[model samples]
Target: MSASRPVRRVDRQALQGLAHPLRVQLYDALVSEGAATASELGRRLGESSGSTSYHLRQLERHGFVETDPARGTGRERWWRATEEDLRTRGADFEDDPSAAEAYRILDTEWARSRRGRHESWRASRREWPMPWREAAGESTSHLRLDVEETAELMAEVVALMSSWAERTDGRDGDPRYRSVEVQANVFPNGRPPGVSTD
Candidate 1:
C-alpha cells in the first residue's frame, strides 16, 4: 500500500477511461511491478506492443499514468501509475447511466485483478523464504456493527496502513525489502442466522 500519493477519486470521464479490462490490467501492472516500457508490459501481459502502446497512451490521457523520465533511453519510454489508490462513488454518477455502468465495470475488474494476484501468490508461496511465507497471508474477522461503526473501523484501518507506508517510504533499494501487497476489505455481511438488525 503506497500512500505517499493522495487517493484519486475517479470521475465519470476517468471511469470511462479505466473501465476497459486491458487498461485496468496495464495500470495494475505498473502499480504493482513499478515502471515499465510499453514493450515490456506487452511481453508480460501477452499483448502486442502496438496494443499496449495504444492503451498506455489512453491511460496517460486520463492521468492514470505518466512517463518515468529518470528511466529509459530517448527511443524508449517507461511509465508508472500516477496513483496507487483510486476510489469511485456510484452516487457521483447516479444521473449518468453510462458512467454508472463504467463504474461497475471498473470496480468488478479491479477486484478480479486483486483476487488473481492473491491467488498467484498463494500458488508460489512455497518458493519464498520462510520469513516471508510466515508473514504473507490473509486474515478475516466478523464483527457486529452498524453502518457508522463499520465506516469508522475501515477509516482507522486505512489510516494505520497509510502511516506504515509513510514510515517505510525511504527504504527503497534495501535488499531486505520486497514489494508487498496489502488489501483490506471491510463491509457488512448479511445478518447471522440468529442475529437481529435491531
Candidate 2:
C-alpha cells in the first residue's frame, strides 16, 4: 500500500514521544492490521479502551499514527498508521543521554514486536495457502564488509523495498494481497574474529 505521506526521519523529540512500550505496540498494530477504533484495538491488544485511546493519542501527537478518515464516526475515532517509513539512528541522540535512552527503549520494543510477529507467522504458516507457505520465510547472508560497504548494502535494500511498495500501492482491497513483513538485520558478529576485549 502507498503511504499517505512521504518517508519521515524521526527526530529526537519524536523518538522520545514514541518510546513507550504500549504506544509502540499500538502503532505497530495499526501499521500491520490497518485501521481500528480504540475499543477494537483494546480487544486485540488486551488493553483497556482508555489505555489504548491514551497511547494512540500520544502516537498521533508524534505523527506515527493518524485518525482514519474513512473508517469510524466522530465518536468512534478509528486510528491508522501514517504509512510513512520511519528512519532513526542511535548516533542521532549520542549527545543527549535521555534521548539515547528513549532510542534504546523504542529500538528494543520495536525489535521485540517484530520477532513476535515472525513467531506468530511461523506458528500459523501451516494454516495458510500452499503458495504463501512456500513463498514466505526468512533468510540470512554472511558477508565480510566494512562500515561503508554495509551502509551501501542497506541503502540498496531500502531502495528495493520502496520500489516494491510503489509497485503494489493500490492493491489494498485485493483478496489475495496480504500484509507481509520483510525484515533485514545487518550488524557485526559479536567481538569479531580477532577482537580483544581485555
Candidate 3:
C-alpha cells in the first residue's frame, strides 16, 4: 500500500511506464515546484544529470510535462506540467490493471518521500523554541462527508495553503520563512475494531 494517499487522479494512458521511482519523483517535483531544468532537478533531487534527463524523457513520453520556450536552456531542457490537475475517468484506471498498479506504485513512492520529510521535520522540530514547536496538533477520527463536500473542503484547504506559498516576501531572508512545504492529510487515525466498509 502507498504511504500517502494520492491527490490527483491519472488516466490509464498517462499511468503507463510511470511506475518507475525516478519518473514519479520527477513528476511530483514538477507538479509541486513548477518548472525546472535537468541540471536544476538533479541538484535539487540529488540525482545525476544523466539520470534526470533520462527520467525527463520518460515523463515526456507519458505526456506529463512539456518543454517551455520562455525559459530556453539550449542544451538543457526545462519542463512544466501540461495539466493543472491529473484527472482520470473510471475506465482509465479502474478498467486497466497495469495502470492501476502504476498508480499504486506512484502513490507509494510519493508516500515514502512524504514520510521521509515528515520524519526530518519532526527531528528538527525540537531545535526550534517551545513556542514554535507547540503550534501543531494531531487528530484521530472518522470523517463523514459527502464526496462533493469533501472535495470542496480540500479545495478550500489548498487555497489557504497556496495563499501562504504565493507570498513573495516573508520573514527576512531566512529559508523557512522564504519557502515552506505543506503536507495536509485528512483521514482516520487508526483502524476501527472489526469494521470493514468494503
| Candidate 3 per-residue lDDT over residues 1-198, each given as its tens digit | 212222466656667757788887888877666678988899988999999988898888877778966676678678876544454443457666777777778778888877876787788987977866776544445677766877787788776755554444223335454124567775434466588868
Root-mean-square deviation (CA) per prediction: 3.5, 2.1, 7.2
Per-candidate TM-score against the hidden true structure: 0.89, 0.92, 0.62
What ranges in model 1 sit over 4 Å off?
Answer: 1-4, 170-175, 191-198
Per-residue lDDT tens digits for candidate 1, residues 1-198, read 444757788888888998898999999998777789999999998999999999999999999999987788888999988845687777899899999888778778889989999999999999998999998778989997888999899889987877777777755447777778898999767776698889
The stretch of ten residues in a row with the least summed lDDT in candidate 2 is 1-10
Please report the candidate that would top TM-score against the real structure: 2
Question: lDDT of model 3 at residue 175?
Answer: 49
Ranking by TM-score: 2, 1, 3
Taking all chains together, the TM-score of candidate 1 against the true structure is 0.89
Model 1, position 145, has a per-residue lDDT of: 88
Considering summed lDDT, which 10 consecutive residues are worst modelled in model 1? 165-174
Residue pair clashes in candidate 3: none
Candidate 2: what lDDT?
0.87
